[model samples]
Target: EGIENTNYFVQTSKKKVILTIFENRVKKSAIPKFMEILIFCSKNRIKCPKPLADSKGKFINEIENKKYGIFSFLDGKSKNNWNKRDCFLVGKTLANLHNKNLRRSFKLVNNLGILSLKVLYNKLKHKINGLIPNASKPISDEIKFLTKEWPRCLPKGLIHADLFPDNVLFNEDSISGILDFYFSCHEILAYDLAITLNAWSFFDGQFKKEFFNEIFKGYETKRKLNKLEKDKINLLLRGASMRFLLTRLYDMVYVSENELLEKKNPIEFYKILKFHQNLENINDYIK
Candidate 1:
C-alpha cells in the first residue's frame, strides 16, 4: 500500500505487526528520527505506529545491507473516497498533530522542498516536452513563480507533509490512525494545510468547495490560521500541487520498478495546478 518502503504484515501467535524494509529512497541515518516522531505521537495519545525495539534495545535493524523496523499495526482501513465528516476528522487530526509542543527543537530537512523540486524539474524538463507536449514551459514558469513567491516567516511546525486519503485510516465514523510519516518535516504550518487541501479536496479532476470549507471549519477548532496564512494559501496550494506533480512525473520517467508500488498520474495535479494559476482572487479559494 505504501509507495516508498516494502511492507509486510507479520502475524505472530501473540499479535500482528508491520515489517518494513527501508527502500533506497529512505536514508538509514534518518530512521531513528522517524521513530522519534512515532514515539512522540504515542506519548501524546495520538494513534500512530509504535516502533518495536529489539532485545538489544535498538529500534532499527540491518539485514543484507538493508535497514528495517517492525511497528505495531494500526487497526483501521484507509478509504478511497471520503465524505464531509471524514474530511473534517482528517482536518482536525492534522491540526492536532501540528499543535503539539515538542520539548526540544528538531530539525529534519525536507528533501522534497522548493529547491529539490527545481532540481527534479530540470532533470525531467527535456523529457516532459516529448511526453506531455507544451507542459515544459508552464511547469518551468511555475517553478520560477513559486520560488519567487513562496512565503517565509509564516507559522512553522512539525507537519505530516503527505496527508493523503490513503495515509489516514478510519474505523466507522472516527479516525483510528494516521500513517506514512516519512515525508514529515519542519516547515510552514499553513503549507501543511495546503498539502492536505490539495490531497483531500479534489476528485475526478475537480475541486470540491464543501470539502474545502469543512476542512477549514474543523482545523480552526484546534489551531486557527492567521490572516497571512489565508492570503498566501493559494500560492502554497500551487507549491503542493507542483511538488506531487514533479514526484509523480519522476516516477513515471525514472525506472525504479517495485511490485509493491504504483505510480500515480501527474495529470491529476496538472489540472489542479491550472486551477490555481487562473484564480482571480483569494476569495475563490475560500467563501
Candidate 2:
C-alpha cells in the first residue's frame, strides 16, 4: 500500500495487526520517535495506530537484521474517490492534530523538508530529465525559487506531513485512522495544511475549488489561520508540490518495481506545481 515500508497484515484469533518492516531509506535511529508520535496521537484522542510492545517491553525489534514493529490495525479502508464531506472531515481531523500541544512532548526533524527536497532533486535531476526530456531545467528553476522563497515562522507543530488519501482511512463519514506517520515531523502548521490541500483538493487532474473551500471551512472550525499563514498558502502549496514531486521522482528513478508497492507518478505533482505557478490571484483561490 505504501512505497516506503514493507507492510503485511497479520490476523490471529485474537486480533488483526500490521507488521511493518523498515525499508527504502527509513532510518533505524528514527523508529522510536515514530512510535512516540503514535503514542502522542493516541493520548490526544486522534485515531491512529498504537505500537505494541513485546514481552521485553520493546516497541521496535529486529528480524533478519531489519527493524520491525507491530501496530494495532485500524478498522476502516481508504477511499479513492472522496466526496465533499470526506474533504471536510480530513481537514478537520488534520486541524485537530495540529491544535494539540505536540512539541512539548518531543521534536522530530523533518527528513523531507525544503533542504532535503533540494538535495533529492539534485540527486535525481539527470535521471528525471532522462525520463521526461527537457524537464531538468524547469524543475531546477522551481527548486531554486522554492528554496529562496520558502516561508518561515507562521506556526510550528507536529504534522503528519504525508496525508494523501490512501494514508487516511474512513469508517463511513468520519476518519477512522490516519496512517503512515513516517514523514511526520515538526513543521509549519499551515505548510501541513498546504500539503493536504494539494493532496485532497484535486480530482482527475483538475483542481476543484468547491472541495478546497470545504476543506478550508472544516479546518477553520478547529484552528483559524493567521493573516500571514493565509498570505503564504499559495507559496506553501507550491513548495508542497515540489516536495512530493522530487520524492516521487527519486523513487521512480531509483527504487525497483515491487508488487507490494504502487509507485506514484511524479508528474502528478509536476502538473500541480504548474497550476499553482500559473495562478493569477491567490486571494481568490483560498477565500
The candidate maximizing TM-score is: 1
Extract clashing residue pairs from model 1. Answer: none
Q: Which stretches of candidate 2 lie above 4 Å from their native place? A: 1-3, 103-105, 258-261, 280-282
lDDT of each: 0.86, 0.86
Give per-residue CA lDDT, model 1, range 1-287, as digits (tens): 45578889999999999999987777888888989998888889888889999899998999999999999998888888789999998889999998883343458888899878889998999888776679999999999999998898898878889999888889889999988889888888888998999998997777998888888888999988898988888899999999999988888888566444578988888889999888844589777
Worst 10-residue lDDT window for candidate 1 reads: 100-109
What is the Cα-based lDDT of residue 29 in candidate 2?
88
Distance from true location, Cα of 74 in model 2, Å: 1.1
Angstrom error of the Cα, residue 245, model 2: value is 0.6
